[model samples]
Target chain A: MIRVLEQIGRVFLRLFEETGLWFTMLWRTMAWSVRPPYGVGEWFRQMVRLGVDSIPVVFLTAMFTGMVLALQTFIGFQRVHAESFVGSVVALAMLRELSPVLVGLMVTGRVGSSMAAEIGTMRVTEQIDALEALATDPIQYLFVPRVIAGIVMLPFLVVLGDALGIGGGYLVAVRLMHANPVQYEINTYQFLDMNDVWSGLIKASAFGLILTLTGCVRGYYTTGGAEGVGRSTTAAVVNASLIILLSDFFLTKLLF
Target chain B: MTVATNMEPQSDPNAEPMISLQHIYKSFEGKEVLRDLSIDIARGESVVIVGGSGTGKSVTLKHIIGLLRPDSGHVMIEGRDITEMRPVELNRFRQHFGMAFQEGALFDSMSVFENIAFPLRRHTKMTEEAIAARVEECLEQVHLHGVDGKRPSELSGGMRRRVGFARAISLKPEILLFDEPTTGLDPVISDVVADLIVEMDRTLNTTTVTITHDMKVAFKIADRVAMLFQGHIVEDGTPAEFQRSENPIVQQFIEGRAEGPLTDGTNE
Candidate 1:
């Protein structure tokens, strides 16, 4: 019993130290990120890639999700006289929950994983160190552009997701669920307030920053060889996904 | 060594030594690598430190260029202690030095032209046209004319080493460090790199520090040679002096002896 307890204590201590180092690095990276000598071209390029290029996939996901939600709600509301409220329900849910969560997940897989792998390769190849040797700060060259691109673009992508999802919900409710199109549109626009969109957008922005930062951090600290880089890439995806899920719950609670 | 010490000229009247390492000590984990290692490189002097693997040869180069910090010593560049430099000061100090890694650590994502132009784009205020001209001149210096659009992976080993040399001297840094410039190359390619080192040293008068296990390269380019053993410089002299050394470690190493002080011949 004593040995087990001692082992548990050691594990906890190790965890604490690891977490402390991670936070310290995160804070230092953030501090360095805001300072001058920004890479405008790289930031612009990443913004287009992360934001503009991702819009179509986000739109498709949101539209199908909204259609399904309206379908499900219609079946349940059929027995009661609550059919009129279906539009409101789907719109509110899509805007407040699904849009942010789905977009976050998609971007995590696409942009987050790529950032990790690219930076990990650079780290292993000594390109990052070479950048430092050339008097170009690696954080400014590498981290800030990705972080800025994520934060600036994710909110817009969330907005696109929210709009398309609500549109799909409208199409399903009015056409398939046998509701009046005008009335359904009115209900969705009226019931889904600005606060719903704003909260989801805020959460998306935070999620974007979190995922990119964690991915880059993991890749930057990777060691060993090819195996090391592979392990780091895997760890980056897993940890970014976990942080997104955990932070989503907290942000949802805090905002609501 | 005493004779070589007497031949050591006074410090340059117009400028200080390009780089100096004083009592630099480094250790990884519990193993000490460099112990009380001191090297003074005058302006335009080409110094080479020769040793077997794990004798802190590369670590010494890294210390001089401010890549790795020494545990209990100072790395002085142009009479300034770079170990205590702030981030900005260190970046400025870095601009004065260039390195060609053993494996030719060129940026894989960049084309040859871009890799050579990288430091100029990052550190200098030169215009794009001038940068291009400089890049061309540097490539020509390494005899790598054309092939600027090719990536590092597309290049052969000798080509990559020449590209590494081109990139190192692109900005014409005052001090250049080459970590095993001739490792794993054919005799002809090795001679090419050694000649470039000598030619660059002569043309640009750049103070050069080369770390190598290749005795031929050391004898060719080095004005002074230092042999590292057991974490300190056990021998320091000219190439001729090094060839005629009486120290068993130096003699054993030069003779490629697996016995004597190097191995103690005990593993059998």
Candidate 2:
């Protein structure tokens, strides 16, 4: 019993320690972002890599998710003779929840993992230390560009995702389910206020910060070697995904 | 156990040492790595630290550059204690030093030219043409030629180490540090590297400190040699003085004997 209690206490202490480190990294990243030699070229390059290059995967994931949501809603609404509401349901879900969440998850898997792997390799190879020896702050040289890219570009990805998702729902409902085309179009816009769109864009920005910060933190402190890089990459994806989901609940609660 | 001797060299009394580690103590996970370790290196001196694996030779080098802070104690550079400096201040302080790693540690995303040009581009306001000229000069200093467009991954180990040298000297820093510069190289290449270090110290006139286990490399490049044993400086002197020292551990290490106090505990 005493050993189990000690183990539990150790786990909590480790958790608190890790949380403190994460926040400290976030603070340092923000502090460095405002300093001189902003490296706009590197920031823009990361935006292209993390956001633009992820379009294809985000596109497919959003499209299929919207289609499935429409299909499921249509079948359920049919029993109640409320099949016309399926379009509204799909649009509302896609804009206010699914688009941001799915885009965040997809980018976390793609860009976040790569960020962890790249920086972790640098850590193990002493390239990061080399930066310091050259009078460069590794945080300013590395984390700022990536964190800024994640923050500014995630909302844009979600906007594209939102459009594709609604379009996919339209195709499923009007062409396949044989719903009234004109009503489906009208209903999709009817229930979605500007508030719904704003809420999701805001959630997207928060998730952007979370994912990038997690990746940078995990990579910056990585130890061991190739195995450590792999571990950090995996941890970055898992941590970002879990935090995105967990934060979504709080964000929805706060926004709505 | 044979007692180790502290064989510090005679120096001018009035002149201060350029770099000093004053009684530093460091530990990792409750295991002490450096204990009351102290050493003073004068300006324009080429000092080589020799030790067994994991004796904190690299740790000492890191302390000199303000990369690793001691658990307690001061690292003094030019009479100023760097352990009291803030991160930004320390970064500014680091501009005075250039360090080359064992494996080069070149940015893999960059070409050789870009890697050498990195510090020049960051720290100086020199025009691109001047930066190009300086990069060429640095590469020339290391006797490397016309591999600018190639990636670090494409270069041989010796070539990569040379490029690292070029990059380190790009800024012409006041101090130059080499962490096992000749490690994992062929004997001929190691000899070339040792000669380059000697040449760079002469031409650049920079205070130099190197960490290595190779006694030949140490002797060839060092104006003075210091041996670390059990987290302390067990021996320090000129190369000749070091060779003539009566310390048993120093004799055992210099002879490269497998049977000695160094391996006594592990075998049993």
Candidate 3:
């Protein structure tokens, strides 16, 4: 029992240490993101990679999620003969929760993992050190642009994903479920407002910060070798995902 | 203490060294790597640090550039202790240095011309025309001709290292560091790198600090040699003095024999 308690204590201690290091990276990224010799070109490049390149995957995931939700709602509501509520349910679920959360997870998998791997490879290969030796701030030159890109692009991606999702629901409901197209559009519009979409965009912005910061922290501290790069990349994906889920709860409570 | 004190006088013969590592000690994950290493390099001198594969040869060079801060010691460069510097200050301070890595840590994402042009693009306010001329000159000096737009992945190993050297010296720094510069190169290429080192020292008058296990590279480039054993410098002298020394460890290392003091723990 004593040994088990000691192991738990060590785990908590490690968590605190890791949190402190992560916060330090955030502070540095914030400080350098505003400093002189700004990385305008790098920021735009990351915007294209993190935001523009992710459109297809986020769109597909949102579309399928909306279709499934619509079908599921119609099936359940049919028992009470309340099929008219399906459109409202689909729109409310999408704008308030599904689009932000699903798109966040997708971006975490795609951009976050890739960020960790690229930076980790650079670390192990001494490219990071070489950058430092050449008098360039690695945090400014490498990290700030990525974090900024994620923060700015996630909302835009969420907005696009939300549109695709609602459209998918419309297509499924009117064509397949034989619902009144006018009634479906009216219900979705009346039940969903701009506030729901705004809350989701806010959540997406937070998730963007989480994914990029976790990736950069993991990659920056990576040591050992190729094996170490592999470890950090895995850790980045896992930690970013867990943090996004945990924060989603609090963000939902606060936003609602 | 003395190195920090002699900061003012520019032309004095008794001025402090250009680089000094005093009483450095470092460890990684409870494994002691360096335990009280110290060395000094005067202006215009080429110093080579030689040791076995893992005796902290590269670690010492890293400390000099502030890449890895010593657990406890003074890494003095240009009469200032670098351990006290902020990251921003350190980046500015590193402008005085040019380091060539073992495997030529060129940016694999970029082409050779862009890789060599990185420092100028990042740290300097030079025009595109000036940057181009400078990069072209550096490529010619490193003897890599007409391979400008090719990616780092497209080059051979020797060609890649030469490009790395070209990149390192893009700004024509005051100090040059070579971390196992000839580790995987063929003998002819190694000789070419060695000649470049000599030419840099003679013509550019840059103070050089190189770490290598290759005694031939050491003897060819070093005006003085420092032998690191375990974690400390056991011998410091001219290459000729090193050749005449009777220290069994130095003898084993220079002679490439595995039967002497250096091979003590191998069979134990």
Candidate 4:
């Protein structure tokens, strides 16, 4: 009983410390966001890297997901002779949850992991220290560009994902399932409110913030060596992924 | 060291140190790295701190640059106590310093040219043409030619350090800190880097505080030598004085002796 209590206490202590570092870094990054020498060039470069590069994967995931979701909806609805509702279910689900959540997870793995590895490697090789020595705030120079890019670009990616996903549902509904095209369009439009799409976009932005911070925090404090960077990268992806999933629950509850 | 009449340059009370560390005490986890450590580096000076591995030589340079804060002490850079400054505030102070790390620490993401131009690009409003000209000039000074497009990973250890030196001198900082700049290089390459240090010191007139285990590097580059032992500076003097010093810890370290205070069980 004592040992278990000690373990629980240690975990809580670590969580608090991690939370403190996260908030402190977030605050500094936000403060630095408004500071002079705003790195507009760096931000655009990162947008191209993080957002532009991520579009294809996010697009593919959403498209395939929509197809699968539509197929599943058709299977269940066909049995009940309620096939008219399939388009409504697929559109509502994609707009309200699937597109944003899936895109968040995919970006967390792709961009978040790479950010961790890059920054963690920088830490191990003293490149971050070199930045410090060069009189450039790493938070302002490095984190600002990345975090801002994440927050700004994630919604854009999600909107694209949502479009591709709905289109995929349309393709499957009309072409594969042979649903009436006009009826399917009407049901999809009738079921999805602007709030559903808006809520998902907001959740996407929140997830983006979480993913970017996870990479920065893990890399910022990375020690040991190459092995340490590896560990931090893994932790970055895992933490970002966990944050995305957990926060999705809260966001869905609040937004809905 | 002659106990009766030593000619080593003692810290002149009247001379103003461009950088000073007074009673610095630092520890990592539970291990003490620096305790009651004090040193004064004068303006336009080149002081090479030599020590065995893990003796806080590099830590001293970091403290001066405000990269590491002492647990309790004063780290004054240019008459200002840097230890009291926040990390963000330290950037203003660090502008006065240019440092070259052991592995060069060049950003792997950028080309050699961009790596050298990083400080200039960030800190100055110089146009692209000017940045290009400055980068070429810095590269030429360090004797690296036409290798600007290459990544740090593509360069040899010597080439990387040359790039590191080029980057460090890009800002023409008042103080230059080379942390074991010759550690992983061949002897010939080490001499090349050492010569660059001398040339930089002469041309830029920058105060240099370097940490190294290489006596040859120390002898070639430093106007004065300070030996750190077990977190304290045990001996400090000129090249000739360092060569003639009778201190056992110094002797053991310089001579590579397997027995003495360094190798003695008491320290362990």
Give the DockQ-based CAPRI class for model 2.
high
Q: Candidate 4 on A1-256: residue-level lDDT in tens?
A: 9999999999999999988988999999999999988979999998898899998899899999999989989988999999899888888888889988899889988998889889999988899999999999889988999999889999999999888888899899899999999999898888677899899899889988999888988988899999999999999999889889998999999998
Task: State every prediction's TM-score relative to the real structure.
Answer: 0.91, 0.98, 0.96, 0.96
In model 2, which runs have C-alpha deviations exceeding 4 angstroms?
B1-12
lDDT of 4 by residue, B1-268 (tens): 1111112223565666788888888999999999888877888989899998888998988898988889998888877999888777888778899999989999998999999989998889999999999999999888889899999999999899889989998988999999998898889988988999999988889999899999989999988898998887888888888889999989988998778898787554
Q: Which stretches in model 3 have alpha-carbon errors above 4 Å?
A: B1-13
Clashing pairs in 3: none
Candidate 1 regions with alpha-carbon error over 4 angstroms? A1-3, A76-81, B1-16, B264-268
Best by lDDT: 2
Name the better of 1 and 4 by TM-score: 4
Q: Candidate 4 falls in which docking quality class?
A: high
Model 3 / residue B198 / CA error / Å = 1.2
lDDT of 2 by residue, B61-136 (tens): 9999999999998898998999999999999889899999999999999999999999998889999999999999
Q: What share of the true interface contacts does each candidate keep?
A: 0.53, 0.90, 0.90, 0.93
Tens digit of lDDT per residue, candidate 3, span A1-256?
Answer: 9999999999999999998988899999999988878869889999999999999999899999999988889889999999999989988899889999899999999999889989999999999999999998889988999999999999999998888888999988999998899999998888777889899999999999999989988998898898998899899999999999999999999999
Candidate 1 vs candidate 4: the DockQ winner is 4
Residue B26 of model 1: what lDDT? 88
> Residue B75: error of model 4 in Å?
0.9
Candidate 4 displacement at residue A128 in angstroms: 0.4
Q: Give the local distance difference test score of model 3.
A: 0.89
| lDDT tens digits, residue span A100-124, model 1 | 8889888888888878888888888
Q: In angstroms, give how far residue A39 of model 3 lies from its true place.
A: 1.9
Candidate 1 chain B weakest lDDT stretch, 10 residues: B1-10
